[model samples]
Structures are given as C-alpha cells and as structure tokens.
Target: MDKKSPSDTAEFNISAYDQAEFNDLLFENMPDYAFVKNDSFKIVKANSAFLSMYPTNIRDKVIGYTTVEDYQPKEAELFLARDKEAFEQGYSETVETITFPDHRIRTLLTRKKRFEAIDGRTYILGIATDVTEREELIEKLRKSNDDLDQFAYMASHDLKAPLTAIAKLVSWIDEDHRSELPVGAIENFELIKSRINRMTQLLNDMLTYSRVNQTPHEKEEFSFKDLVLEQFDMICIDKEFNLSCCELIVSLQKDAIAIVLRNLLANAIKHHHLDHGNIDVTIEEKKGFYLIKVTDDGPGIDPQYSSKIFEMFQTLKPRDQQEGSGIGLAICKKIANHYAGDITLIDQPNGTSFLVTWPSVPTQQPPFKRIK
Candidate 1:
C-alpha cells in the first residue's frame, strides 16, 4: 500500500473541518447554550448565540480563555471540585447559578465525558440555557391565575344573597297576586323591580371591576387629558354637581396606564361630594410622568376612612348615601399595581384630593410605519 502524501493528509483534515462546521450549523440556531472545554476545564469553544446571551461577556471576552475562573471565578472553584468528584466517581454532575457581575446568574447542567484526542489531549463538553425570564413569567402567570380564582370565589358568594331575595320576591308576586293586585300595588312592584335591577347591575359591575387586571387588554397610545375630558363630558349631564373646567395636560400610555386613568376618573365622578358644590380635576406633567388630581370641594372624606376605601367592599358611607358597589377604588389599586404605578390621597380639610402618578411611556418616537 502506498503511503498517504502530505497533500492527502491536508485534504482529509479540511474535510473533517467542513463536517465540524456543518455540525455547528445545527447548534447555531439552538436556544440553549453549548460549549466545550479541555480536560483542565479551560473553555476552548462557544457557539455564536451562546456568546450573545451573556451581555457581560461577548465573544472576545470568553473564547480561547483558560479556566472558567477567568470569567466565572466562583463557579470555577465549585465546578473544579465537582469535576474532581465526577472524574473519580465516573458520572456526570450538575451545577447551578454561576454568578458574575451585575447580579447576572446562569444555571448550568454539565455532562462530562473523558475522551482522548488523536494528539492525546482529553476534553469535556457542557450545555446550558437561560431559564430566568421563563421562570419569572411562569411565577407571575401562576399568581395571576390564583388571584382570578380568589375573585371568582368572592364574587359568587357575595352576589348570592341579593340574587336569592330578588328571585323569591318575583316568585311570590307571580304566584299570589299577579291578577288581583290592589291599585298602587303595581307601582310598589315596579319600585321593587327597579331596586332588584339596580342591585344586579351593581353586582355584575363589581365582578367585572375585580377581574379587570386578570383580563388581557390591547395597549395603545391614548391621551390622559382626552380620557379625563371625556369623563367630564359624561358627568356634565348631571346638573346636581358642577365639574369645573380646567386645562388638562396630556399623558400617554405605553402599557396598561389606561386602566389607571379609567378607574381614577370613574371614582372621581362616582364619589364627588355633591355638598361641596364643585369638583376640580387637575393634570400636571412633571419629570417623566403625569400627576392626576381629582379634588372634590364636597364634604371631605374622613382621614380615618381614606385608607380602607381601596379595600374590596369597604365603604365608609352606606350604599344609600353613595351609589357605588365599593369596587371602583379596589380596581383602581389593581390596575395601578399591574402597571407598577401608584394612587394615593393628598391631605386636605373638608375636601379630598386623590393623586394618581403614572410613568410616561416614551412617545417621542413616531408610530411604527413601514418604510417605503
């Protein structure tokens, strides 16, 4: 047999290089990170996507680096200890939360294999994926579902009493006195019917308000001034209370900021102190947010009763005193929390002002339009 020439050896090595490139292509698009190391645990290679995942360490920061200690010093120490154990025991071992600068952490499951190269060098390979965002989203979704479940249980239980009474009254009227009811009895029956209708409407509205956070919404750019003015126009129809006209500043929503405005405005309209005779709605734009003030010159909300107003079904005044289901402020709180914003009251005597703060979504950039 003829001995292989130098050129033949070069060609054979080139073919092997091509095959390695082909194999890398398969992993190039993979979401998980893949890497290789020598027997000494020095990183020899890392894929393109793997390097991109870690903003702290780009390709130049990592590849061809000696020892995981160069980047992940803590993980290097622990991994070396584990490697020794695995080498002796002859089994793969896992490691977690390999930390670096800026609170960045990655969990890695490393599988080890000892293999001798043609040049007599041994190597080990490892694979890992960033599960941080996935883990957090899962946790948030779980909590959301749990909250919805609680709301369902509460609404069903509370609504039952009014519904049962209304049903019984209807049955009694139909069975006992439908044909021979005395004069004016029909008017009394109509009044009862109206009361039941109102109660049913209130219960349904309360349930809807409680579940607003759980329901998904389409986020869009809307002016806070526009919403406030719209509410003002609607409330203007009620001549009993005068809503003052004030120059409103514009505010934008990048996320669910609309919900914040909706509930706050609704509360302002629903709870205005008619006795105070005037309501002042002010909007101030400052820093990177818009501050909303709904000031009622009416009988001031007692300082003692202010805090509990946001609690579900907690009302300072009886249902007769104020026509409210007691869920509006609770919904305001839920929406504020959902957007990572807050709503609170400012101190004032014989009048109350609710201050709503919302972080502005950057709207300086033009809306997305396809480039021609």
Candidate 2:
C-alpha cells in the first residue's frame, strides 16, 4: 500500500453523509420529543424520541400522516391550529395536556418554529418537553404544606382549652390553700403560673403565624396615620412612647396589613431598653413599592442576628428574659412574602430601623376561596 503523507491526513474532510448521520444521532438521543411537519401539519420527519409516543410496532405508520389521522379529532384540531399559528406568526409555544397513543396523559411544554430547510422547503420544527412529573410533584408539595398548616392550626386551637383549665385549677389551688402552703410551695405555684402564661402565648402566636396568609381579606382604602392609630389602640403600650406616622393613603388587604403593623409595633414596644422611647413610622412611595420605615430610639438588634430573627422560633434574647414566642417576625415575613414584598432591618447608628417594602399592588392574589 502507498504511504499517505501527513498533509493528506490533515486534509481529511467530513462528507455530507457523515454530517447527516451526526444530526440523526443527536435528534434520536435528545430527551425531548422532536419532529418536523410540513405546512399542511403532516409529520414528514420524526426522531426516535417522538416515535416513542406510539407503540413500537406502529411507530413506522406515524410518518407522512397528520395529527388528525393519529389522534382524536378535537386534540388534532387544537394541534393543527397551533401549528398553523406557528407558521403564520413565526413561532408558537404552549404548555398543554396531551394524551398519547399509549393512553398515558402528560403535561408538555411544546414549542414550534417555522424554518426553511436546505431544499428551500418551509417546515415547522416542533419540540416537546414532558413536565407531567414535575407538575405532579409540585402539587403534592402544596398539598403537604396545606395539610401541615391545618394540623398546626388544629393542634394549637385544641391546646388552648386544656391550658386554660390548668391555669384556672392552679389559681384555685393557690387561693384555697394560701395560708396552708409553705413559702417554697407558693413560689413554685407562681413559677407554674408563669410557665402556663408562656404556654398560652406560644399557642396564640403559633395559631396567628399559621393563619397569617391562609384566608383572604377584602382590600380597603385607608390612611397610614389612621391605620397606625387603630393598631395602637389595640396594642395599648404602657410606656409613654411617641408614635409618629406619615400621611399616606393606600389600598390594601386591611386585616393582613394590620397584622404586620401590629406585630412590628408591639415588637418595638416590647423590646425597648428604655423607660420611654420614640417610635416613628414614615412611608414613601417608590417606583413599584411603598417603603415603610419604622424607626425606634431603643436598643437596636445585633446585625449578626438580623437574618436569623425572621425564622420561626428564633429569638435574639432568651425567652425568659424577653417574653416572646419568637413567631412575631416570622409572621411578618410570611405576610410580606405573601404580597410579594419583604421586611428588612436597615442598618442605623442609633436604635433599630426596620424597612418594609410593600408592593403598590399585590403580585399574587391570595389562594383562599372568595366568599360570594
């Protein structure tokens, strides 16, 4: 055999035959369904992935046939219309539920684009990605979350009755045996009462947190000043603290917003490290959201714990030192997220400043069923 020079090896070229083989390999190996259709919606070419939708024995019959011949008339008509739209509009995409020849239903994200082949023939190249399993998993996760919330709500509600009865019984025992009990016994009874009170608070906070965004409330127009004043009446801070708010009117879910404001204001008052301090609320209309800043002249929160404070059952100070169930900020965060907003602690030199970003309009409507 004649020896081939190095130059001859370097000049080796891939023929059209090799290129076609490579393209076929890629199309067949792809994980998504791939097909080519003529202007009339006839399946002219289909990859193995697309053929897999039909039985192996009848796969060969799929080519050169329109969807109307292979699928139900209603389903075929919808697909034909989508294909025609793609050719007319240049492209079309949709997420649709499809029933295959195997009788299995699937959710598919499909895209069809009009393109001209090398032979100058216009064709619709279609690709479909199966997303049925993903959607099913998402639905399962949502149901699991709903079940967990129901369990938490019911558990907390049921606990309150027993807790109240125990508290009453303890009070009765203390009153009935006041002189007969020893000093240590009296102190123990007081501790028991304190623990009972804490338990009650915990259950109440749990119920509130679980129910934060579960139910929908009607949106109402109200002024910032009036809303804060209304919450203040309910909170009733004992210390002489200044409450200042800007005059801004907003239309929002009134009851939900009230929960957020009430929790934040109560936190400021409860955690104040002074006999009397100042609490100021200012609102500014931003481009897409309203900035509500609540500034207090009390000791500020540690920056290291800023992110942690928003988590459920997280508290900077010991529960004994600070009487809290630690669900206040978590509830606030949930309510904010429900409206596609957020709450963050703004870094300030003196005292803590919490910046609340509330969207001008809710990004997503609450999932609760509307009352007729």
Candidate 3:
C-alpha cells in the first residue's frame, strides 16, 4: 500500500491540470464569450461562444487577429486603449455593443483581467456576458414609469380643473332653482356632488401615489402625537375621531408619514360602526425601523379580503353605501414600500389594526415582517 505525502499530493494536483482533455472540456462548455489575448492584443485562444461571433469562413482564422477592423475607427481606438489598460491595471470592465459578422447587434458586459502563465508569458483573459435583452427591458421599464408620471400630472392639473368647474356649476344650479325643483332633485344633486368629490379624491391620491417615491424623503424631527393628531383633524373636521397615543419625538419623512396616517385615520372613521370611536397608535423604535400600529374600535375586515384590500381602486363596500376613492390604503402601502418599509393589516377578532414599518432613513433593504 502506498500513500502520497502532502507535498507529493500538492505537486500531483498541480501537474494533473496538464491533462488537455479536462482543460478543453472547461473552455468549450463556458456559457459566456471567453478568450485569451497575447501581448500583441491578438486573440490567441477563444471559446465556442467567441467563435460563434464570426462567419464560418473566418471562424478558423479568428485566432491571432485583433478586433480593429471589426469595429468603427473610433471604437477600435478606444478598444485598443482599454485592452492596454487591462494589461497594465490587471483588470477592466465595460459594457460594449458589437455588430457580429452576421450583422446581429448585441450588448455585452465584458470583464478583462491580466494573467501570467507558468512559462512567464503574459496574457489578457476576457469574459463577456450578453446583456442586450436585459438592457432593453430596463429601458422599457424606465419609459413606463415616466409615462405614469405624465398621466398623473395630467390628471391633477388638466382633468381636475374641469371636474371642479362641473361641481361648481351644479352648486350654482341648486342655489338658483331650489324652490322650483322637484322633491328628490335635491338628493340627486347631493349624490352628484358626492361622486364628484370621490373622483377628485381619487385624482389627488393618484398624484400622491405617483409622487410618493418621485422625490427623496427628507428626514425631520417632530412629535409623533402631533403629526397623527394633525392628520386626524384634517380627516375628521366636525366629527370626533378619538385617538390615544403616547407622545414621543420622531425623526423621519414628515409629509409622507402624515399622508399614511391620514389615510389610516380616515379608513377607521369611514368604516366605523359609530360616528366617533377610539383609535390607539403605538410607535416604538425597532433595530432599524419605527414600528407604527394603528388600532381602531371598528368592525374588522375579513381574512379573505386582506390581500385584496391593498389593491388600487379596491373597495369592500358599494360606492353608494360608502363614499370613498378606495385608493387610500393603496397609497399608504406605496409610501411605506418607497422607504424600504411595509404596511399590513393585523387580522384580529374585535377591531381593525394596521401595522406599518417605517425606516428612519432611506434604505434599499426591506424591514423585517415580524408583526402581531
């Protein structure tokens, strides 16, 4: 029985790479375009994907040739400069567009690194990943976002003015012909006004949704109780919406947070069994976020409609029975998401509770989904 020593095993392992078949298998099976270039900037070795870039006639002759003639004169100069930089700096990465011999254009993210062989010959190893489709998809997504912003702006400025004018004209008619009108005409006018108000609210909320992440949230310090109280007052002017929360100073985006609180308070009041009810808000500092829980003494939502409640333009009740845009929760969800946060309904037996996670600062990492 023979057992190789540690030094002998290391030497054998290094020498085993001399097996040409193993090297050929690895080089041939690479999914990306890979090649090795000599000091002269001529490709000395290339994989199948690299060879596929050329015509059948030129495939065999591709080795020992530079890409100077393949690209435009200016592009060739820049490519040669980058090649030299990779040799000197040890690495270079770039996104390049290439028109193959078959006239198919492709965008690639290319990484080039310098290496030296055991025999002391210097070479540049390059690996290129095709990003043509990914780049196209990203561009389309950017265009789609821009179009939504434009539509929101149109809805706010252009569409809203005409809608307000129509509401005013209806009011003027009601005032001028109140005595001459029929019995149920007054109720019809009120219904018309309510529908108009709902549409206006929808437009405003849509604008808020589009602009939620449009600008960065600026951090500011304020009393949490004060902010919640202000929005509650705005939502429930004459009606009493009782709220109970411990006062604490908070540092976060004030305007966005106010919008979320307003929607939540309005939701509680609008869906409550009585005209006024108790609302409890608890705000505490977690590891990296401000945890906000808004609980109301109202009839809770069904577990089946939990996911559907956050959808845009979704309503649990008919429009005639309850006058609302139904975009409030969706907007609150959007604002929370924009800051690496989340808003979820805490399904309970008695009352409705909404748990909102808000990061103190702007972040890309999502907050933990731990909620009661």
Highest lDDT scorer: 2
Pick by lDDT: 1 or 2, better one:
2
RMSD of each predicted structure: 18.4, 7.7, 7.0
- Rank candidates by lDDT, best first: 2, 3, 1
TM-score of each: 0.53, 0.79, 0.77
Tens digits of lDDT, candidate 3, 1-372: 878788987765644557677787778889899999998999999999988888787787789888668666766686678789889988777777777665688888778889999889899888888999998998999999889878887767688899999999999999999889887998899889988998898888777777777887688999999998888878887667778987889999988899899889889998998887889998999888999999999988998899899998899999889877778899899889878799999989989999999987557543222111
Model 1, span 341-371: residue lDDT tens: 6788777876678887766664344322312
Most TM-score-accurate candidate: 2
Q: Which stretches of candidate 3 lie over 4 Å from their true place?
A: 1-15, 18-23, 37-42, 56-66, 73-94, 113-124, 152-158, 219-226, 242-252, 284-290, 359-372
* Candidate 2: clashing pairs of residues: none
* Weakest 10 consecutive residues of candidate 1 by summed lDDT: 363-372
lDDT of 2 by residue, 1-372 (tens): 989998898665668898789888888899999999998778998988889899778887789987566676777778888899889987887777888987788988788889988899899989888999987898899999899889989999999999999999999998898999999999999999999999999999999888878798777888888998889767855677888888888877778888889988898888999767888988899887888888898899888888999999898889889989999999999998888889999887889899899888657654332222
Once fitted onto the true fold, the runs of candidate 1 whose alpha carbons sit more than 4 angstroms away are: 1-179, 182-195, 215-223, 245-251, 254-276, 362-372
Candidate 1: residue pairs that collide: 276-298
lDDT of 1 at 15: 70
